[model samples]
Target: MIDEVMFMRHGRTAFNLQRRLQGQIDIPLDIVGQWQVDMSGFTLAQRFYWAKVSNIARHPDRLSQPSDPPIRRSDITEYEQAPASRRRMVVVSSDLFRAQQTAHAFADPLGLDVTLDSRLRERDFGQWEGMSREEINERYPEGYASWKAHEGGEAAYGVESRPDLGKRGSSTIRSYCDDPQYMDEPTTLFVVSHGSWIAATIGNLMGLPDSQLDNLTGMRNAFWSRMEPQYTSNSVLFHLTEYDKGPDVADAVDWENGPAYLRNPDMPMWKPLI
Candidate 1:
């Protein structure tokens, strides 16, 4: 029975800035990306006490009522002074550079080490790897249209199929849930991964419908979603603290002269709803 799980999408990168398909190219985070992660770390440090302190330390008075509020440090300096009082935090990152960097931002603040997992890598884009939407449309018009229409299934050229990608996402998530260490108690696991993989994983865990699958894309760079596990006999269930629905919106029209969602879609509907 895992307690809380947080899925963090890596910060922006050069490819992201250009609106290009990075796939697994191992792009590093840009300056803005780094700043975004720093703020996230700062925010987390404020809310909960780090795990360095025992669970007992978090609840000094064992008899404290459930209505008792969490014991949070008044200042950052005070929080850092008592290393023993810090809460325990485990960071897991995709092998990709962007994700690793984002994980580092959170791990460094808590004085924790990051565990890299290849299983968390992004969906391989294959031939569409470094191309932007326009380029992909121009070069592989037929494949692009088919991919969008199906939401996913046919790989762009020789890339990984949507069904396979979704399965990989589901399996990776299940692996963490089934791990004895994470299930030992109420643990918080910060999984730093790609947007596509995150979306697919959430959809897989919740068994979302095809039409609703695209709703998961509202996860902006460096943002995160909190999830909790609900175990059942036949399957593992999860509940998201929050998920963004509706089409992606931009402040202004994109260079494509259309809404961001219409211009560049991001959905992982490899198979029709069952």
Candidate 2:
């Protein structure tokens, strides 16, 4: 009974290329983003035997249906159980286009159904939803420090506070992990969501301090971040209670593992400051 959570950052969005704080911005993934995610999916799927798609299907009742199909598999023809890999699961993004599209790449291979949930949506940026950090600083400098500090009392015009992001977004993930529909399966869990939401989710779960939280940025689209949960007598029972962060092989995680486009499987080197 190994509890594993794979937090995948969404693929490259227009906001990502601009070096802006996407913060709940609903931008589509670029071509490179698609490639990145697909690569992650392939690599991770190979490592595991079966994959559970994040695109969980819900009946009108909103309860996740067990009979719900998976979005991807080990084999393209019929998703056979591979001896070398473990079972994998894909959690489709609630963001219609990005999530669905990302799910399609994996689902089409295994013929699994993609599960969708609004709760997994990126952090609602509030007033800052679509604007970049530079724009925020140019327009309102006073609010910037509060934002950097993650002080939620005051807001940057209409953006969501760090506190609110932690409260709602983190709560949603906790509920998801507890919910049988998302967890309860033995396969690996792959979550697809916005950058801010991903950071907030991990930060809140780990109780990351404000300084640590502020240092994070969004996950690169389609890249998988590693996390593991250990069994402890005192910890919550029958579930993945609190996971550990692993080095993000895809270079996409709660924090940037290293500079992008620097990965060379053959060379295998990690250096700061790309």
Candidate 3:
């Protein structure tokens, strides 16, 4: 029962810095990107560690012995010493170099291996793969205009359509969750993929209409979104619980108190950041 899926966008690349369409170009992360990965990775690992502790604290009956002492700071070290299987988490990534690099940042600290899936690759930009948005607009005014209007004009230029990209991305994620190996446990899947692909997949998972797709904006580099399954009578649907979260937000959390602190009934619930 894959409990949750964390879809993370890879770190910035040279092409990202230059505002060019990388598509499937296999770009590597730049210096800033590496730093982003390092910080976010550390924060991610810390959050996971604390989340495990929180679960134990919430369900003490699950402890090996009823007389076991309350969770303490030393539990962190104990967790690190535990076998990887005890973590109940898996890291997955697009086969692209950038995505794989980002995935490793989270996997290495968590002592998990990354499972690569080529289907998670970024949408093929085709003729505009290496071009900047400005160049595309300048070179193919009509197509660019049509694309901006959400009229599927880019298909004429050999670009992958949004529907096609969404299908590919959503199906790839579904396959992983449906795998027999992951179906029985409360596992968390960390999927590192591309910006466009992530957005499209999320939109599909949430069953967003084409006219409503634009309501969900693109994700920034090194940021992530968390989704949990919401089982309906007909099928299971993923609900977007968090979006565009990153190290900055994680750093702001009150780690000493844990995530539950944020759910205090007296605490004012804030709207999601733009």
> By TM-score, who's the top model here?
3
Model 2: residue 62 alpha-carbon error in angstroms: 24
Candidate that would win on lDDT: 3
- Once fitted onto the true fold, the runs of candidate 2 whose alpha carbons sit more than 4 angstroms away are 52-90, 152-156, 180-185, 209-212, 216-218, 230-274
**Count of backbone collisions within predicted model 1:** 9
Q: Give me the overall lDDT of model 3.
A: 0.78
Ranking under lDDT, best-scoring first?
3, 1, 2
Q: Estimate each model's TM-score.
A: 0.73, 0.64, 0.77
lDDT of each: 0.69, 0.55, 0.78
Q: Model 1: clashing residue pairs?
A: 50-86, 50-87, 50-88, 51-87, 51-88, 52-86, 52-87, 52-88, 53-86
lDDT string for model 3 (1-274, tens) is 6879999998877787677899999999876567667677888988876444433444444345434567442344444444532447778899999999999887776555698989989999999998988899999999999988998889998899877888898888788777888766577888999999999999989898866665678997788899997656666789999998887654765322225533456533322233
- What lDDT tens digits, residue by residue, belong to model 2 across residues 1-274? 3366666666665566566666655567665557655665566555542443221221122223355467532232222233312333545565646666666565555445567877777666666656667787777777876776566523647676555676676676555555665344454555666666766667766677755666656454565455564446554222324332323454463223234454345433322223
Number of colliding residue pairs in each model:
9, 38, 1
TM-score, candidate number 2: 0.64
